[model samples]
Target: MHWLRGMWAAARSGVRLQPHHLCAPRLVLRATAGLALAGFAGYWLFGLAAGVLAMFGGFMTGITTFQRSWRPDPVVPLVCALTMGATTFVGYLTSGSLPLFLTAAAVWTFLGGLCWSLGANSGPIALNNIVILLITVTLPNSFDHALGQAAFLTAGSLIQVVLVMFPPNERWQWHRTVLASALTAEADYARGLKDNNTVHFTPDSFLQAREADTLSPWQAAHQPAGLRGVRGPAEEIRPILASLADPAATGPDTDLSRRQARELLDTAATVLDAVAHAVRQGARVALPPDTAAALAHPQAATVPADPAPRAATHLRTLLHDLIEAANSPRPGRESTDPVRPPIPEQLRQAVRTLRGELRHDSPVLRHSLRSTVVVVAGYLIGHNLPLGHGYWVAMVAVLIMRPDFAQTYGRVASRFTGNLIGVTLASLTLALAHPNELVTGLLIIGCGGLVFLFMETGYAAVQAAGSTYCILGLGLAGESWSDAMPARFALTLLGGLLAMAAYALYPAWETSLLRERLAEWIEANLHYAAAVIHQYAEPAERTALRTRDAVVAARTARLAWEQALVRAADEPVRHRGLPPATAAAAGQAIKEAARITMLLEGNLPQSGTAPVPASSPLATALRQSAREAAESVRNNRAPTWEPVRQALADWNTPNPQEKALHHAGTLLSNALDDITTALDATALDTTAPDMQGTR
Candidate 1:
């Protein structure tokens, strides 16, 4: 009964048609027109099969281009085109024998599923390869014919590559957009802190912008001066914003100081927003007159005293630098330095990352196994069925299944309904009108356009258009509309069912992993906090690097936990070992600890300055307590921070000059106490009868 309910709920959620940002019209129109042209020309010159093959090649390549990947835009189209072309040729070669084809298909399907381990971009490309291969095998041919089809497919894809390579005249558009997003996020955070000091802020945009800043050799040599070093100041501003808004460090808002701080924070928000807008639009900064005056010359009296004023001044300076960077002219000359790792090194790193996922516990490995089984099973059943078009069953399964329950189930529901609507409508149209080749060709192009237009709107809409396009394209070929319609409808239904069943049998429920995710986040935060304290204890070049690495790891772990929480939310599983209330409390406590740690990091002493040796004991205690807390979390026991408290007690009367370190230590101890309290509640919750068993 629970499983049935889960399917119903997932189906409901999946079919929702939410509003989403539209893709660029130019990009959509270009790909659609190119596909239409190729299909029509092929049909006019040669035959319907050749036209359909050409359209398939173009559609596959264009879809890859439409995906949101961190890889260079041009690179994706070219790589995917070549990869799909090769897969098509291979599929044709193996199609002579069912056994050979199934074995090869199983291997290909597993590798395609494993491609997710590489990255989001690689996953889609691999899926496209699988799709082309499946479609290719349905039409077995001789070697020469296979080569001709491969060439036609490559030519179709290369056309899209050309279109992408010479897109609209907006060099560095992606970098500018990401950087602008980061600044806008910071601006929103600043404004949010006015009402609530502890508003949640994520550095995801900043991380993306940082990654975008890593330029290729040609980009580095000719990039604008503004883009090169602006992110440093932008990142520096985040910690300062966190520090200024922290009531623990700055005191309550019941006084003049707090009011002044809020006013300055609002001013900073205004400036940051303006800078972000200018950066995104690629225009000169247009600050308000008063904000401009303030940035030009910050007044001492206008800002609060007690580091707030200095922090406000620093904010002003950073804002000024950002504005300048936004408006700075491009470099007149190019450098000869390489900015990215070599191709061989990158391939080696990719291989190492994939190797790390070979473990039994790895989600990629499990997904690959499931994918291999389901695809091969679907193939065997589809082939044995009296109804033809066997590949449709496996294709439907491949299109719907994903790494997580939420996506897999949601897509299964959406894709099935969509295929039903599409097949019925296209079949009705064909039966009613009996359009000629020209009208059919135009209908195919129109459906293709709809697919691109609704790419992000929702899967249901895309699938609806895609299914219609598939029916029309195949109908334009030699297939009878009546025959294609029922086969497609039944096979699609079978594939979605198979996908759902496979996932149920081998589920990777995020609920089961929440405890480990929470533990990882807690451990990372502790390490980050200890690293900040160590900077106070013994400042050095290597110590700074260590601190940076620790913070990065902490952010990564935090992001992973947040993602898992979201994925697990809609999963209809009761009795999650870690209760929601306990998870929320633990998350809040860890975030507070991380914020306090960032505050300490913001006030780190300058290099070559005298170190606060008194903090050495506290740092060591933090490291020891971190390991203990992680183990306790895994065991569903309360974590103790007695050692941290003791270390703080021992440093109770530190030197006056080390007051910052002393105060930060006190806050850390309190945060650790909160974590302990949260974990105690967790211990109590997990032991309850209601939470004793997993779904």
Candidate 2:
């Protein structure tokens, strides 16, 4: 009954989309188009074997290069194709006996599924090989056949290698674009703060910005030889970014000088825009003189009352680092040497990653077990039922199952819908038109092109195009899958059902995990905020890398909460968590306070300037708020932060630096208050029973 509702809810809704996500995945269209063109040409020239080679090459080309920058010889593509070819030989050699065939297929599915823990894009290769094993078994069992298949695959690989040597302008765009994007998001958040009327810092924009930033470092590493050392993550100069990102990202706008702070934030945005532009063009970053002046003059010692552009001033040093990196060239950083670690280390890491997930409470381990069951169940049903096109059952199963309920259920609905439409059309086509080499070739080309283009835009569309291409491509090999169209569609639906049902085999929902996830998020933010507060109170000589890691960790925990919450939304009445919006406000506020602390890190004691005494109001208030926030966050209770609040209100000593420090304390107090209020609202709401006292 629960599973039925999950399917209905998933099928009724459309896939949730993100903003500006169509940047890189569209490049995949070219590879698919190449597959359609080259695969059929090979079919026409050499035979069915050559066509399969060309088609598989193109398919793997898109999959292998999924996350990498534009470069020749992407590691995963080559590994996948070779694995496919090798496994093809082994599976074919065992095809004569039922026992041997079952053994080979089991090994293929299990071993391939295991590759998932290796890294992103690794699991698909594993699953692809299992499909290849199924596809190969349908052919004659002979070594001579395997050799013919292997030879054509090499030719197809050569074509893909040549094609990737030159790619579109957007190939490495996300890497550099995200560097600028993170800054731009920061700029927007800062500007929001400058308006002085906004309460929330807008968590989604900042979260998206941070996620983008996280992907930049690795992408930049693979951008061919010349574009190598482009400075890692926005954090390289995070101290400056922290301040610039800090004041703008957090605090009480009413507490500070409105006009001056707005100018400071607007100026910082302008500076970042220029930096973003330079990053895109691979040119040196240059800040405008007015912005430079902001950084150079933190304050006039004579007039202690004027607030300085502290973040912008600190940001000047960050600009210099980016400029220096942009102008310099580092050679061969992404080595041509094979990218895999030594076999021993690779095995060790893969085992460690998998073992860690196999705990009694591990979601990933449970998901993996569920996947294994789905694969085995689909195979057993197909084999026993005498379905001629049985591979389609497991093929859809592999494609649809996901690590979580929302995604798996969503893919089940989408894949089943797509396959239904596609297989029906292909059936009509095969029934109406003559089955010849030329017609098959044309269908493959058309469907392949559509598959890649729609991949990121619409899941159902991709499935429709992909299923057509697969059916038509296999028809060229005399598989006659389209002849069994009704059966194939039924099996595809079965695959999807099994995928959906698999999640129930090991139930783990956000409702069950909410307490731990929230606890982890709070703990991470607590450490991050503490590091930031202390830095502001006592300016650091150097950036603390540990503090930066803590920020990253907090962001990670926050993301986990977001993803789990999404899954919880699809769950039953008894299995859901507190709403994301409330949690997000508290979470984002914590990040804002931390970011301000980071920005203030570069406020080193200037040579002639004397440090403020430890007993000063701002200093003492910061210490008190930091202490109170720790307890409040730990217990999910409203803090009696009257000391910090009083300290902020009474610190009428006209000093710009002191005012900024006071604002940081206010941000801390408000953030704690927000956390407490959110928890209270959740506890008071009787509609959801997911959390325990909302703690």
Candidate 3:
């Protein structure tokens, strides 16, 4: 027992248990209770068979579709109920014969599979219940007994859905606070870059901010629907953040708030830029007096008051860490100098940009379709072979493959290994005792509880092992062990092989798609960035854009990039769309942007007090170049580099503000170039095959 507890703790250590992680387990427990209760109530009201079926149906539904936004779709649940009822009616018509009941079960399972396959990928838990009920009905049993099980299941599933409809506690507040702080850090970083034209961006700072952003949305989704609903708030703030680079967008009370928030984010950015500079110089770079002052400023009032203290504390700590790391002398420290890393910042940013977009809504439907197709194909070819119950093996194959590549492999291997162990254990247990209902029930509950505890920790294998024991126990229901044990082992192996074949042949690759999606996100962020630049010219409107708002936009872009990276890493070969050169360029572009944000934040006090001339050549050129590059990326055209060259030329010239503008313009141009190349590459690849066929 002690060893098991130790093992369980070790397994759970890797999983970050946020507020949303609790939602699934709570739903599972409530649904289980509901099913049990429904069985008791319905048994007295409508007899045992009907009660059981209702409970099972309800239980299945609850597990499948309990999301934060879950609203009951009465049509599907009622239809599922009717389907189960009809199956029961047919079994009754057959007069309780074992063979007849089996036939009805098989037919219903096929029908259920077909119905589910149509939109199973998108449908709710009720559909899954239908699938489970179909299988349960087919088990060789009395007609009344099967019907009762289905009824109980259905009632339980319904109860779960109702309970889930009520929202959980607002736990997303901390996540939002973290995101808002990260954004402020970025703004501060950007401001600092504006103060020093020679500064380079640090990848580590961007990586940290990106990580925070990546986790934020998933955490938000897990929160109860009612509490901390800040998607709206974040969206509202996006435009303000985007307009930070524009000079016209700085004036008035509202504009001051945006400026303050941008300044705060820029402070963090400045720290990163300083680190990069220190790395380049091989010594600690002393912060400019103005930059140090900005970093020392009190927390921005624009951020939520509740989160402000934590945010300030975190920012201070992060800045201190960056300084310490920058100052540290170590081997290979020379390589930290900002001469472009192999991967481009733009591509990295694009990849990181997809966290918000990739939502997996239909794990089961995808599993079912992929499984069915693979199994059916295998059965058609292997049915006449030496393999007995080959079709059943193929069905098992479908269950093993999943979309999460790491998880799928882990589950398949675990399940196969655990089954081998479990089967041995179960056989030994049965040798000592005769299987009955009470023993079966106890095993089910014990296994189910273990599964609940370890579900997130590698549930597939645990469940598989449990199922192996349960099935073997069922096979012993009034039967001798010798006859059934051998057949059960053979069937299990057959199922595993079919699953393996399907997994190998029909693998779904998400890597390339993730890259493409991330590229689109980069374009969107660029659009927002361009808008921010334009807004700077309209100072009156800048006040309307809060610092919180700008932070949200930057955070959104960072989140997308993080998600894209995860997906790409999952299947790197499949999604390797950006050429090495292009990827490097993109990465550099993001680094430059981060540095620019830092400089801008750090220099706000110096630059903000005096309004630049409207006709300033540097400002006009920066605005024009950024806008054009943004448009070029959107239009899928090659970005013009001439504006960037001109900006760089000015950056090297004498004017201070002009130099700042020039540096920003150059960075924007580089980002645009990377985006344009990626988009063009995508378009060419997508069309090339079609063009070749035409030829």
Candidate 4:
């Protein structure tokens, strides 16, 4: 019990490394030395049988199978292991030949690929094990030799995991902080996009915001059960984005003001991104120049650095008041003025018609499927080549080929460049000293530690190259470390070419499905906004509605952006015209809508209660005008601001609420005009004959 407690304390202590305090070089050296010693000791004491198994097992565990945000059920790992083990066992029983073993291994690889597409966490690792088992069983080798290798590998994996669990609790904290910072930066970026008014109605900005939003939710979900806390910061941020996306709030006339707001948001977003990056690299967050300026600005300085804290306090107070209100149980009183009947059938039909056209599916999915198929085919072909070590090349291809060619191509170029540098260094190391089993083990540990420390940085390819060198140095398949470089480089190049070819071809059909889907999503969101605004009778209801709207808008925007990429993949010719829109615009619209809805909800009198009125005629006129504007928008009619203008003309109006309502009405009318114009423009451009097939 004491030993267990001690181990727990050590683990906890190790988790506390500050982002900037991690000593990368020392950590790498220590990890390398530890793993090397463990590998050798395991081989000597337990023999190679267990060691080899453990090493392969660890390697399998290290391979990433799913996207970062995916979270599978806890039982998934068990299921994956069972499936992998059972298939291997069956293969061994049915056919005891090398060729048969290779075939089974290939099948296992395909299954792993499928699992990846289906979003499985351990799929790649499971596939690696299957390959290892096949190789061990089929190779003409002594039983003792195979057993020894397996034992050593297993020991290596165990040691690697142990080495990773070291003292430095600050490191973990930094890592978490980094993630949070990235999300924050993304939010700010979205804000900036809206402020710029660069295609305010497009999906580009929304997608980026969605990505950030997704990360936030995932982090919340992944928090350990007992330690889980409320996500108040994200909740507050949600309204800001919602407000941005609300077409009934943000107007073209206020573009300059919106831009200023965006600048502030972008500053905050960059701060967050920097923080996340710093944590991952074991560094501190460094604010950019513009970010510094915004923070220092006199007017913006009043905005809380931590909006979540203020929101949480406010929410708590509001809830308490609500609870008291509920407890007191005020008696219901009849209203002097009767409620209006339901809207006219003609108006309802018109609203339905407008919504139906907007709700049509986008053409993005078809294009995505085509591109995905091409990439997958290329990967299979590259891996299945007659060359001895072509699979590594195939792996590289998988990492580099993205739907967005520019980004994917850049990553591929960087990866290759980094790999070349890493391989050269590894070759020199091998030449300097014959990489014995001990050296090989040390290298693996060293690579693992580097990966662990710098996984957050944009240098994953370099880390992969280091890991590759260590793996090859182990003298597997009678291959010498010194001679492997030339073949490895050639194979990697071939894989890249194949991937490029696949990207260039594969889509035989052209359609605007992606665009249609995006438009539909936007239309659906608009309808949702209308419903929420119309039903804004209570504060609690408004808050819930706002949150839902923000989330949905973010998600839809992300989908639209992703679809656009997919569309570009299928129709490269159209890529130049359909530039990615900033996610901030959509976020801003959503945020604005949320804010207004909240205001309306807050202003609503309690059940059977009437709002206090001003004695002045100007106040009465302003209130009436606001109500008319709201009604007009709800009825899908063009809102006229003549009444609002007349009300505003009276400068000495004494009623604050009336003045507020008049201003709100004016803003709403402007927003409606901007939205209508944007929609018309989008419809015209998208429906053009040449652009019809792009989406």
Best candidate according to lDDT: 1
Report the Cα lDDT for residue 408, model 1.
Answer: 92
lDDT per prediction? Answer: 0.79, 0.59, 0.44, 0.42
- Candidate 1, residue 227: Cα displacement in angstroms equals 3.6
Tell me the lDDT of model 3 at 61. Answer: 46
- When summed lDDT is taken over every stretch of 10 residues in candidate 1, the lowest stretch is 330-339
Model 1 agreement with the true structure over 212-235: per-residue lDDT tens digits = 776777677666555655666677
Model 1 scores a TM of 0.94
- Best of the candidates, TM-score: 1
Residue by residue across 379-414, what tens digits does model 2's lDDT show? 778877766766667778877876667667778777
TM-score of each: 0.94, 0.77, 0.54, 0.55
| Model 3 C-alpha lDDT per residue in residues 1-695, reported as the tens digit of each score | 53244323423432223323333555456545544555456556876455444544554443343322211233344444455445444545553554453354444433333333333333333234334532453443665555555445545546644554444422233333343443344445356434443344323333343333332234434533222221222222222233333332222324554445456556555554554444333456478776677656645323333223333344454455445444443311112111222337634643443332233333233344555565455444444555443344443444544544444444555555656666666666667765564465445444444444344444444555455544544443444455445655676566655665554454444443444444444544444444344333333335224322443454565555555555345432423344345544564565445434433332232123444332144444544654565555434344555654564565443555534544555565666566555456544544322111111
Off by over 4 Å in 1: 169-171, 222-226, 247-254, 300-304, 330-340, 540-542, 684-695
Backbone collisions counted per model: 0, 3, 101, 78
Off by over 4 Å in 3: 1-32, 35-134, 137-150, 159-369, 378-395, 404-407, 464-469, 472-489, 511-515, 539-564, 567-585, 594-663, 670-695
Candidate 2's displacement at residue 380, Å, is 1.3
